[model samples]
Target: MTTPMNNKNSLLVELFVEELPPKALKKLGDAFANEIFGTLRKLDYLEAASAKTTFASPRRLGVHITHVREVCPDIAVRTRLLPLQVAFGPDGEPSPSLLKRLEKEGATLAQTTRAFEQDKEFVFLEKVAAGRSLRDGLEAALHVAIENLPIPKVMSYQLESGCELPGWSSVSFVRPAHGLVALHGDTVVPIEALGLQAGRETHGHRFEAAVDPVVLRDANSYALQLQDEGAVIASFEARRAEIARQLAAAAVKVGGGSVPIHDDALLDEVTALVERPNVLVCSFEREFLEVPQECLILTMKANQKYFPLLDAQARLTNKFLVVSNISPDDASAVIEGNERVVRPRLADAKFFFDQDRRKSLASRVESLGKVVYHNKLGTQGERVQRVMHIARGIAEKLGDAKVAAQATQAAQLAKADLVTDMVGEFPELQGTMGRYYALHDGLDAAVADAIEDHYKPRFAGDELPRNNVGLVVALADKLETLVGMFGIGNLPTGDRDPFALRRHALGVIRMLIEKDLALGLDALLQDAAAQFSAIAGFDSSKATVELRDFILDRLAGSLREQGASAQEVDAVLAPFPQRLGEVPKLLAAVRAFAALPAAAALAAANKRIGNILKKAPEADAHVSELLLKEPAEKALHAAMAEVVPAANAQFDAGDYTASLQTLAALREPVDAFFDGVMVNAEQADLRLNRLGLLMSLHAAMNRVAQLERLAV
Candidate 1:
């Protein structure tokens, strides 16, 4: 039965199908609901305050919308024709053009009028067009919504025999659709999609549903009916919250300050895998806890979708929480089944750990030679050799023999774990497992930590390496990758960064700035580029220049993200400061200098001086006192004599803010000189002398930053 025509009411639409991919469920749900709402609103089939609610589960995707209209109101539409003069003759009678247009529009001369548009008069036809009906609008909206869904993959399946149209043998969708429901109030608004007919029937939990094919009562009662009879929590967010509450309560029941390990992605996946969540406490053998907690936690979370509990000190405990879809009075059978299933998985991890320890990391180094790093480059062994040399070069720049040796050792052993049994089983454990093996080999604590810390800052906001040796190796590793990739002309374009060069550049910047390392940016690039000379196609000279520009651009963006204004960043980075550690101080000085009352005048005068110096390209910073005949030029020279030395001393002392502030004293003389002196004098020496005077003042004023960039 259908609702009465032209009535406004809340509407509901649902698609019941096979289980969806848990990782992509949320995205699919959002895309479906938003596309439907947008299409309805575009067609003027919604009330002003119409709102939508989304529901998704393992076997269903649905949306409930309020204040939908059965029929949209009529609106006025205009159709343009030929120009006024062309449409009518000199006698004011309709011409052939007007006749043809009127015939096509089904209009008469009385229905046509002259309107002004685009600075010209045109003949236009005005008509009232009836709005679309709900059935027509909704059918179109459904097709659009389904077509635009962000399905990770699609599958084709044959419709049921004798159920659909005779020729409709197959259909394609993210999953096979079994039923669809389109409700307007208590009445079903008939629609068809994916070889399924619209109805109020939707199935719930496979085993716990109180009724088969639960029938919804109305558009507003779908969620309640599903929960009361179907034993399903239909809304994704509500179900996730419920699971969280149950997980927390289950932890409390276990005592010993145990809490389920927190991973939002795992929580989301668990929420999508169950229609009705039942958090059950399960346990495994305690001997497996001897393995690294990361390995165990990863195995459980990634493979079993189980939450391993952590004690008060955040150590993994044997007790874990599992979110099951069914809740029987006797949960012991289910608990035991899960426990028995996880035992072998844990044993595999234990076996791998025990076997991997038999051979020291140094012995595994030879195996890396057989594993290819990049075809254009060389094997993993060759890459490791490059990284060791680069690390040594960087450490030597710091002038510490002990740190240099430590960095080389760490770099040499970093990639050896790539061939280990544990790392081969779980690639994410490559660096982590290396640290364990290094320690077991009786290596230094610093070297062991560096093996793991070299991959620190794997993502944004991640921590940096812990020790100086780690820092040196991390920088060297990132630099080697960056220089090698850029040399091959393999660069990131738009959103596609297969090489992750941008990340490597940012990592280098963060370490240099955060650690305040006294390293020159150009020299680092040069040294890195120097290691790639053996490769045939590698262009060291060109890649080094391009890579430098790339890194500086990234630094400018980073500084802006950290709250520095664009202009301030430009001023500080303009000179391309070699010691990147001093960038923060330079920016601070620029900001401080910008706040002074004399700052505006000084910046403006500096800009004017730059323009004048550009005209006299041969001007040097040597001002002859004898040629300083004008009072303004002499006063400026005298002021610089007193202030330049003091500013230079402050700049040399690394007191950047004080250095810029000291230059503030020259603003008056600078402004007076620009206003009173004619820099382009007729005599050659006079003009050259004046230009040299301005050049000296410009040099002194811009010691901390390019002050002209602060000009408004």
Candidate 2:
């Protein structure tokens, strides 16, 4: 609690609680910061030079505010009065009773009376409200903010006994609030109304200095005290730097050499798990290394929250690093305990791996029938059959019969490992486990890799399929899930994606574009819809359309993410066929075309032609060269004829920018024809022929894009 050199206001709130879950701690810290600031803004109490800071540990959540205004700014308020004619007599004199009521209501002297519409008059009343003290505003705001802290699960202590807490407060937070500290410079602000007392004392790490509370004389001193006596590094950046230095030193000491500890998630978790981190290296049995490296590492990380180490070759080492909250007197004992806990888990994994190998990979395919994919979509076995059909179609289109057969076989066994004991225990290892089992059973290497790589991009920013077989199976898997869900009407709504269909759709798009694999999504989806319809008894066409639209939405989002403008995307999609791989090329063309100076003029010319055709009568609109009379029309037709071949050639070579340039050459001729010609001539034959010429221009423009749709 630092003393204010000048008169300034501030707030401090601290919540003491039992141990909080690490995951919930970060969420609560963010929620409290946002809620407090929002409440202050809503009440118009936010003033110049305000700062808010939040700190959280397993046992406590605290927030501090500094340089807040001592009082809110004075605000001007206005009140509108009904027409004076209605309140007063026709002679324009106020009624005696009305004047008395206005005075009683605290109405200020009228600033002016002005004539409004319809012979009505309005009177205005204005006043300036005096500011309130910071303490008064914060006291009211604290009550509202505490109630709004978004603690989904809460409990109540004995404080509200016999009195029903409001539904909002009935829930108790992960930790109960012990007390609050409110400070205005060096002065302690009294806040007894909300069961809190302003205090100058705060605690440090429970293990190192339990009950040794430091009296915070000022805001600056409070921060310094925690650092010196409490051994608490309040800043996240300082803590991270210290952890990295300790980890590097520990890794160097372990003779196996320093391994890149690639654990950003673990780093974040460990940072939140402790205020003062003690990084130590611990080793396990070398015999346990024989177990699958992934299983060992995942078990250590997932169960014990340890960071796995890798050797120079990027192989998993037998050692791990654990970040603890307290520096131990005997560090070796902690290492021994962690090693003991990890051994049993690794032993279980090794056992499951050996037991699963006794059966052939082919035999496990039967177990998929018992695994439900979705309630309405039948079993995993049935979905595999659908994937097999889709994969075969994709393979045939790619002209790779051998790869298609291999993909079909891989899809059949992909989900079979879901029934394995190891995968049941660790859901993240579904495809990885399957690939390992297939290889152990002497399946083809390609088939085994396909099993694993088909699920490559499980989420955004994840890897995509590396082989054609994997690519086909990946497409099939995503298509089935999307089509089946849409058929059953389980589409994702705003903020509610139960099935993660969006990820699947985006994964499919990335596989096609990034890998440059040419596959027609519309055709594949159509086939999938048909298969689902036949098995489930519904109209497949509607499902095909819905699924296509869903995928298109994802494609649009992906394109936008790549920096394509909204209008450019619409321009490309307008003429491009709905093929997964073609979208990337179309987008490229649109981007290139948009950069050309001619593109704007071409778009304007097309829009003019379209507008003219909209007004022309549908009857007698066929182009007949014999009916043409005007030289401007004849010249425009010749110019279009000359550019058509060049435009088509440029488009075929994927040079859309060149094609747009060729199209723009017609713009001048088009303008001249419109300037000199009357499209709706008295001669019906001439009018029809002229209209047909305009229609031809519209069609040519549409070959590149529906320019009207590309309007920015």
Candidate 3:
């Protein structure tokens, strides 16, 4: 494997196997490539800045790394030996322990003793080792690369009689391995992987290949040879781009100026499923369009791996694009075959929709009892009742009887679609099908819209609810989940939130803060807990605190994601403000206050004042005029007397930035008071008076935000 006097060369490694799991293909490819590339780079066989390309097809995973050396460079390594005390005896001559260490290090007495004495603390043996050959490094790299693959599922299969045991030769991998190829430029590296000797040959498209096993010429020619001779596009990303471009072209040829469905996961899955992708236009019966576009699109993408074309307005059309592995002279058969295959899928969706609509959404409410929400939290019917109670209270908080009635209606019918055939077939369409059925049931549009939008902002960056009714019900639904889950002690631990409690909490936070709903988070949680009165083993008082902290923790993360520094968010969130809507304003106030010239000095003074107040005698914000002895104390008192009232008024008027910025005016007097006067004075009256002044200043500075947290 040492090629042409150990010159640098591009390297290639390919492992041909059965089709990989589509979802895990990208990760598996990346992990395998990085593992091999990183180990070689660490050993100095490849540089950090070398160019590498990862290729993942349905049947193969490969990597091509440039600027890889045939032999790694020699390195000097220091090996630690015994401690300093053992290196020398009391007689000051070379100790017997030192001589044994020197023998193991293969060093002379004079040289080893001189080198060891310089450091003396710990004896370190130094040696210049020869670089590794490419064959040896590649063999080790292959072992590591295969072992570290992020395989979603592993299989145990029999190998072809290579093991030491008599009748037991088995290999476990993501898929059954067939061949291994390792090339340094044009040279074949002498190594074995998965019981297969290294070779330049790999199988390509099983049916359409020009040759049985594509013979790769060199590292640089692998992709081109696969494409030209083996009829396969070996690069995953290149094949994906080609499929996308062809889909767009095929949609244009259909004359509707349509666009294929834009789903990244679907695209990635299809890319993993094909070697040579030929996107062809296909169509289903136009009557299938009467089914919900989501149902058709999902069935096409999920089951058939087809891209349903949509018009410019993003409405599904009858036409779709199919990525074919074998590009026949006429793709008519492939197109019709896919069209035939998808017809039954679309028919089933239509059947489910029709069957679901024959009965009203209201009729499905009682069936929710058959569905167990959680063994501890009772059934879905009971959960609906809890959500209904919370929703009604929120609606009443918002307005009169009309809003409350609508909210009640929406919350009651919210989970009814869970029992519908359409939703049962496709669990993802739960809330969506509910909306369609509600509208079909002659319910008000607002009620129908609420059913759909209740699950809004389902994931990050998703849209929020459409209207106030939806907002209230969404808040109630999420609150009920949090409260019930917490009451049952099903709190989320690290990476194990089976109920997605964090998402539910963030959803609730998003609705409350975004809608500026008048309900406080604590009030909402308390009401939700009350609805679970019949539940056993529920401790509402404790659960409510946990719920508040969990939601506020999510809020801090959300705030940080929106560009608020951790310090600013901590300052605003320390008090856990009642109106979460005002949190953004408070953060803005902190940011604005922090930008002020006196803000740092004021924050530090506030921190010092807080410490002083904590240690001093308990006192309210009341000062004795006669007890003010120092000039700085009198000035701070006068400044606080003026600033506190104005700041309090601004806080009451909802100008948090103005409130916090106004307190910046007292920075000079605060600095003077801390520098010139002592709060723990000799006289009791003076000490209490100074403490009172500091308390008043501290309270004023922290009303809008916790200024002490802003202290460096």
Candidate 4:
């Protein structure tokens, strides 16, 4: 017998699209990658190493895979057939008369073999399926994956001259599939399905050479050749590194140690927009620096996809760097072209800034009513009123009346920028524009900062509210969103979170936990739910619970992301309506208790306690001191008496670990009582008494968590 050796190797795949929008490019790449993984898994290709790398410029969307397995594993296929009795007459064998009739009619076998499953008792046939060559499998898989790749929009193109005018019109792709290069090892696999012939050829820059094709020996050689031939670097990290290096050098030349590269999104867009990126330094009028630095940077980044340079003082400099995909013979022309494009954008930004500065923040209040928030939610003005009320409630909870009042004022004016011409043109400038406009309009710095920071931590890993007023507004804003949508029964279903209520709830949870504010969610949700009463067809009570559960789910997910186990998350969350921030403290306690040597034993004891109490008829009975017969039961009772106060103290102090430690002291006595005594004794009163003692034990542990749900 020969043993088979496992082949552990990577797979490489690349998709060449005509062009893709940068915003949609990442998602498309991710989807394709996910689909490939899912499809391969379904096909029983578990050992195949795969990764999808996507690259997009104006002309092409390229995806490269690495570490893909050569072939799916060999599988034992089986087919089941109908039992012999069903195929023949009931004479204990095939009947001669029936056989003669079947022979005359040319009847075939009554049953045939199908695929294998464990549920079948018998199989008629079984075969060992040999794995195909990596090249063959990859070709087949790639053809299917490419044709099925979901693109929001698709285009078609004409094909080479063939009899009957080659069916390009019948083909569809995200963009017209201009060309495809499918290489297996060193050989090109002909793709006959898509009307493409596999060739050891690929093109460089479209303008650099009209049709220069290179043969690739493998993936590594192919990547190198593509870069050497004026093709843009296909790797995202490589392009980012090149951009960073060029930006650094430009900063040094401008006598600044570094420049502020503010927009990560713009950087990603620029990186995707180019194949061969060349960094160029361009100077603008120094007077432009007088404009708010944010406005200038936003204009440059949003319009031109340029990186702004700053001096050592961290102030904006007159210099900016632009990344150009094409290498220019006269670089000055490119610089001149970029400067011309940036001028009008900067002029418009300055005009908006100047115009916005003239209006007072207080005066902008009336304008907020003109901006619609949501169709059913009335205007921004109404939402602000809700937020103001919520903020005041939050402030009262925080014991900060002054900041609460400040938050109220801030919330009322927060949406004022929505009515501004500047924010209307630049939607991204909503909170930011408010802050800038507020500062210019001579509002208090705290109020202006609150207006801006209320939208903090907008995405994962983003910063949360820094100021008290900001925190109040953030809570109020999120609460209103959750309450309003949930009241109307427009809850998020699976991936369809149209209102972004999940994000809002998650943000609220993060803000509260991060700020360590001990405000109760129940009261807050109740207040928020109350506001929607006047609205038609609202269910306030159900909405309140749904909103809390939503926040709690996010909290659990966030904790799990921080390396907490699912069991631990459930154990911590088992107690409903607890302080949201205290969840981590509770989990830490549970984990600490779990770590102790006696923790498992204590958990076992608690489990037994719960089980006994569940079977008992009534839990109202108390064990009398006179009824205690066994020394173990007496010892357990004494231990519970001593541990209860200490456990309660630890729980109150938020020292869950200490509480669990205190509870663990009862484990030995609990074990002894269970081992020595029968919980369901013949004497009804005695059994009832034993059950009551166990109920008492449960009561002490339930102060922290329901132990039954935490079962191992």
**Best prediction by TM-score:** 1
Indicate whether candidate 1 or candidate 3 has the larger TM-score. Answer: 1
Better model by lDDT, 2 or 3? 3
TM-scores for the candidates: 0.95, 0.90, 0.94, 0.82
Give the candidate order by descending lDDT: 1, 3, 2, 4
After superposition, which runs of candidate 2 have C-alpha atoms over 4 Å from their true positions?
1-10, 41-47, 77-127, 160-171, 192-194, 234-241, 595-597, 611-622, 680-684
lDDT of 2 by residue, 643-698 (tens): 97888898778676677667778878888998899988998888888889888878
| Cα-based lDDT for every prediction | 0.90, 0.74, 0.86, 0.72
lDDT (tens digit, per residue) of candidate 3 on 445-479:
98899999888779988899898888888888988
Candidate 1 C-alpha error for residue 233, in Å? 1.3
Cα error of candidate 1 at position 35, Å:
1.4
Angstrom error at residue 662, model 2:
1.0
- Record all residue pairs in model 4 with backbone atoms less than 3 Å apart, i.e. clashing: 10-67, 10-68, 11-67, 11-68, 49-67, 79-114, 232-275, 232-276
Q: Each model's number of backbone clashes?
A: 0, 7, 0, 8
Error of 2 at 63 (Å): 2.5
Off by over 4 Å in 4: 1-17, 24-139, 148-150, 160-169, 182-189, 210-237, 260-264, 611-618, 621-635, 672-695
RMSD of each: 3.0, 3.7, 3.2, 6.2
Q: After superposition, how far is residue 653 of candidate 2 from its true place, in Å?
A: 3.0
